[model samples]
Target: MTLYETIFVRRSVRKYDKTPLDDETLRGIQKILDEAERIDGQTGRFEIVVGSRVKNATAPHYIFAFSEANDGAYANVGYVLQKVDLYLQSIGVGSVWLGAGKPVESAPDYVIMLAFGKTEVPLRSGAQDFRRLVLGEISDGDNAVAQAARLAPSAANSQPWKLHFEDGKVTVRYFGRGLLKAMLKKMNKVDIGIVLRHIEIALLKEGKTVRSVTATAAAGGGDLTAEITYVD
Candidate 1:
């Protein structure tokens, strides 16, 4: 299925069948990750670990993402891994983002992970299945682009982002501040990257492209992690 189609059907499935996928299917998922984009532009690693090696979850396979510690590293990890998550679902495999577990040892800078296998759980049957903020609630554009951003997931489901459109450009800002900023800045950057992916997919469906996806400091006496400019 196309990424656009898969977006509506994907689910964060935690319970998966213990049966390992055949080599062919595994190879397909590997191919998807191999060609996936890493938006954070830093040193990173992806690995395939068997269920026996993973601690918290029981699944036939786990895909791991590791990156050198840096500003926005976690968000970059999310940006890259979200594509893999969608592709697995496109091909009928289950996946969920795991923030709690880690490699037993000898693993360093392990930023994030994805757990995948077969499952009986259904992806969203319709758009109504998504429990996301309305367009007016999170963004100024109130268009397809904003809708895509609205559905992007965040750590603890925080959904901490704001979208601005001006002069045909789209600027995303980290909206929560003060105690919220103190709490979720790094995590919000990661969530912004995930929203960026969603924006790209939605734009592509609409025959648009994102140009010069850049991270810029916010104007209000603090740092805003990242933003994207749109181009036809």
Candidate 2:
């Protein structure tokens, strides 16, 4: 299936089966990780780490991902990781973002962990519905983006983003109020990128195209913006 198709079918999978990852699936994931690293480059500033755990240790099997904590970067990490997660799902691998209870740890200044594996539990009932938001009913243009932005995951799903729209551009502001505010700012960038990804996906599904995404801090006090222009 295509990447967008994967995006549509992918859901957060929390429970796992006892089955182990096959050689082919492992190779495919490795290849994608390599390509993602190259595409992300130094400008994007993120990394994906894959590891395995003993059965019953936590999840039967998993892949852990992290990136250096820098301003406006976590959002990008989320964006990139979402794509990686989608690709994994396309191959019949189950995955979910590991939250507070998982045994994952962070380095001194790093954003850590996305759990991937095969699940025994049936897919969650409302998982697909969770991705939906009302675009037509959004009165504040920026909030429309923010509504979508809220869906973008952050460290522990903290969601520390605020958006404002002006003229033809959308501005994304970082609130930086969480405990790890500095780390959150970097993660927020990847989150912004994830938000951008959702905005483009939603628009394309509606037969619209985004013209551009430019970053600006017009809202002041560390607020970051992504000005999106629509295609006529």
Residue range 82-154, candidate 2, lDDT tens digits: 6667677777777776534233444454454566767754433432555443433222463334444445445
True lDDT of residue 86, candidate 1: 77
In candidate 2, stretches whose alpha carbon ends up further than 4 angstroms from where it belongs are 5-9, 37-57, 99-106, 121-128, 131-171, 175-190, 202-221, 227-232
Write down the TM-score of every candidate: 0.88, 0.62
Could you tell me how far off, in angstroms, the CA of residue 217 lies in candidate 1 after the best superposition? 5.2
Q: Residue 47 of model 1: what lDDT?
A: 85
Best by TM-score: 1
Name the lDDT value of residue 39 in candidate 1.
63
Would you list the clashing residue pairs of candidate 1?
75-190, 218-224
Looking at model 2, report the run of 10 residues with the lowest lDDT sum: 37-46
**Per-model C-alpha lDDT, please?**
0.74, 0.53
